[model samples]
Target: MSDKKIITVFCATGAQGGAVARALSKDPDLHVRAVTRDVNTQKADKLKSLGVELVQCNTSNPASVRDALSGADGCFIVTHTDFGKQNSFEMEVHEGRQIADACKAMRVGSVVFSTQRSSRVLGLQTRHMDAKAEIETYMHDLDLPLTCVMVPCYYEQFMGLFKPEKIDNNKYILEIPMGTTPMHLIALDDMGVVVRQIFNNWQTFIDKTIGICGDVLTIRDVAAILTQVLRPKTFADKPLTVNDYRNKKDFPGVSDWANLFTFRMRVDQIFNIHHTKMIHPQMKSFEEWARENADTLHNVL
Candidate 1:
C-alpha cells in the first residue's frame, strides 16, 4: 500500500475545485482524488490524465459524500448556490452540511472550505453569501479540523457577469456598485495555490478562518487597468449606486449582489491581501491579470 496522503477534491470539474485538484496533483507526497457528479466529461478526463482518481459524487446525498471522503487525509470543498434554481439557498446549505458531516464521520485530517462573509451578520440579506457563512458555522459546530478560506470577487468575472457594456464608438462602461470602496479580487487559479499551501501545513490552519485576496482596487482603478492593458478599447467606470444596480432587470441575483457590494463597502478587511501574498508570493494584481487575459477580453469585447 502507498503511504502518500490522500486529498479529496469536490466539484473537481468546476473552476475553484479544478484549480485545487490540478495544484495538488503535482505534489509527489499527496494523492488527489477528484469527485464530480459525472466522471465521463472532458474535464474529468483531463484530471484522470493527470493521474488523479475520479469518483462520481452527488453532494446532496450523504452516502455519496461519505463514500468520496472515505480514507481522505484532506479535502477541498466549494459549494455553489445554484442561483435561478428553486430554493437555491436551502439546497446550498444542505449540501454543505452533508459534506461537513461526512468529513467528520470519515475523520478527515484537514478540510479546506471556500466560503464568504455573511451579509446577514451585518443585518444585510445576501442569500448566496449567507448560505456559505451558514455552512462555515455548521462545520464549526461539527468540530472538524477545518480551514475556512473566504474568497473575494473573482477576477474572471470580467469575462462574464461583470463584462463592460458597449454603448457605441468603441467605448464601454463598467457598472460595478462600489462607490469608492476598493473591491477585493482574486484569480480562481490563485485560490488553488493558497489551498495547496494550507494543505501542505494543515496543522496550523485547523479551525482558522482565512480570507484570501490577490488585489484590492476601486471600480475606476479596474477600468483604468482595462483601458491601459486593452488599449484602443476605452473602458469607463459608471457611477452606479446599489439602488440603481438592484433595479437592473437584465439578470437574476441583482439585489443580492447589490446588498453584497453594500456590505463590502461598509465592512473593512473581508480579505487579507498581505497575508495571501505571504502564502502565494506570485499572486496576480488586477493590472497583471488584465494584461494576461487581454486576448480573451478582446475576444469577449
Candidate 2:
C-alpha cells in the first residue's frame, strides 16, 4: 500500500472550499484531492494546475463521498448554503452526516467543517442553522478529530447589501434587520485563507469550534466605509419589521436568519475582542475587502 496521505476537500469549485483546496494544494506534505460537480469548471482547471487530484464527487452521494475520502488524512467539508436555489439545507446536513460517518469509518485524523456563526448559547430553532448544531453533535459522537469553524456573514454580501437604487447611481442602502446593531462579518476571500491556515495546523485546532471574523461592523459602519471607499452616499436601513420580514416572499428562511441576528444583537464583547484573542488571528478589514473586490463593489453600487 502507498504511504502517501491525501486531504480531500468538498466544494472545490466554490469560494471557501476552492480557496482552502488551493492552499492545501500548494503544501508539499499532503496530497490534495478536490471534489467538483463539474470537472471542467475554471476553478477545477485552476486546481489541476496547482497539482490537485481532481475528482467528481457529489456530496449528496454517500458512495461518492466514500470514494473521495478513501485514504485521506483529513477533510474540509463546506456544503452549499443557498436554500433558495434547491432546498439545500436538508441536503447539506444529510451529506455532512455522510462525510462524518466516512471520517469515523475510515478513521480519518481530522474533519474541519465550515459552519455559520450563531449562538451556541442561545439554542437555535431554525432548520439551516440547527443543521450545523446537529451535524456538530454527530461529529462529536464520532471517534475522529473534529473541528467546527463558525464563519461569520461574508462582507462580500455587502456588495448586495449596499446596492444602489440603480446600478449606476451612487446612492447606497445597507439592508440589515437589526437597528444599527453591529455585526461580526468576515471577508470571503480572507476567510478562505484563514480556513486554509486552520486546516494546515489542525493538530493545534482539532476538537475546537472557531468563530472567525474579519471585522466588527454595523450597517452604519458599513455605510460609512462604502461612502468613503465607493462614493458619498447615505445608509438606509430597510424598514422591514420582524413580523413584516417573516411575511415576505423572499424570506423563506427568515426564522433561521432572525435567530442569528437576534442572538448576535446581545453578545456585548465583540467577536475579534474575545474570538480573536482565543483564536490568535488577525483578519482583513472591510476596507481591505472593498479594495480586493473593487469591481464587485462598483457594479453593485
Candidate 3:
C-alpha cells in the first residue's frame, strides 16, 4: 500500500470536484484519484498531466462507484440537480444514496458531500435543496464519518439565471427574488480552498453540517458594487416577490428559485459568512470577486 492517503473525487471534470481534485493533488501527503465517465477527454488528460490518477466511474452505476471507492481514504461527492430538459429530484437523491452506500462499504476515512441547506430549515420545499437534505440524513444513518458542506448561491449566477439586462445605453437592470433580504453568495472556485481545509482537519468536521458563503448581499447591494465596476449610468435593482417570481411562466426553474428566495428571507444567516472566513481565510468577498472578474462580468452586464 502507498504511504500517501488517497482521495477519490467524483465529477472531476465538473466544477466542485475539479477544484477539490486540483487542490488535493498539490498536497504532498495526499494522492488524488479523479473520477469521470470518460477517461479520454481533454479535461481528464489535463488532470493526468497534473499527476492525478484517473478513475473511470459512473455515479449512476453502483458497481462503478464501489470500484472507485475501493482503497480510497476520503471522497468528495456531488450530484447535479438540473440536467437540461430532464430534472428529477428523486434522481439526485438516488445518486447520492449510491455514493453514500459505496463509501460506507469501503469504509472511507472521510466523506465531504457537497450539499444544500434543508428546505425545511426555511419552512418550504425546493427540489434541489430537499434532495440534498435527504442525502445528508442518509449518509448519517449509514454510520460513516461525513461532512455536509453546504455551498451558497453561486456568484456566477449573474452570468446566467440573473443576468443583467440593458434598459438604456448606460443603464442596466438586475432582477432578484429577494426584495431586501440578504442572499448568501460564494465564488465556486473558493469552495475548493475550504474543502482542502476540511480534509486537512477531518476530525474537526466529521458529522458536522456547515454552510459556506463569501458574502451576504442584497440586489441593491450588488448593483452598487457593479456600478462602481461597470461604470453604468445607474445600475437598478428590480426586486421580485417570491409569489411573483414563482408565478413567472417564462423563467426556468421559477418555482425552485421562488422557494429558495423565500427560505433565504426567513434565514439570513444560513451560510454563516463569519465562520466560513475563519475556515478559509483567503476566501474572496463579492466585491473582490467582482473586481477580479470585472471584464467577464461587464460583458454579461
Clashing pairs in 2: none
Question: TM-score of every model?
Answer: 0.96, 0.84, 0.91
What pairs collide in candidate 1?
none
Candidate 3, residue 224: Cα displacement in angstroms equals 0.7
Q: Pick the candidate with the highest TM-score.
A: 1
Writing each residue's lDDT as its tens digit, candidate 1 over 177-291 gives 8988899999988988899999998887778889999999999999999989998999999998888888873677777888889998888765999999999999999888888
lDDT over C-alpha atoms for residue 97 of model 3: 96
Q: What lDDT tens digits, residue by residue, belong to model 2 across residues 58-115? A: 7777788788888888888886666564556676678778888877878788788876
Looking at model 2, report the run of 10 residues with the lowest lDDT sum. 160-169
Question: Mind sharing the TM-score for model 1?
Answer: 0.96
Off by over 4 Å in 3: 40-46, 83-87, 120-123, 232-234, 249-252
Cα distance off (Å), candidate 1, residue 258: 1.4
Off by over 4 Å in 2: 1-5, 82-89, 116-125, 160-168, 232-235, 238-240, 248-255, 266-270, 273-282
lDDT score of model 2? Answer: 0.71
The candidate with the higher lDDT, 1 or 3, is 1
Best by lDDT: 1
Residue pairs with backbone atoms closer than 3 Å in model 3 (clashes):
none
Q: Write the per-residue lDDT of candidate 3 for residues 63-134, one digit (tens) a residue.
A: 999999989999998876762334578888998999999998899989999987777866676888888888
Error of 1 at 147 (Å): 0.8
* TM-score-sorted candidate list, best first: 1, 3, 2
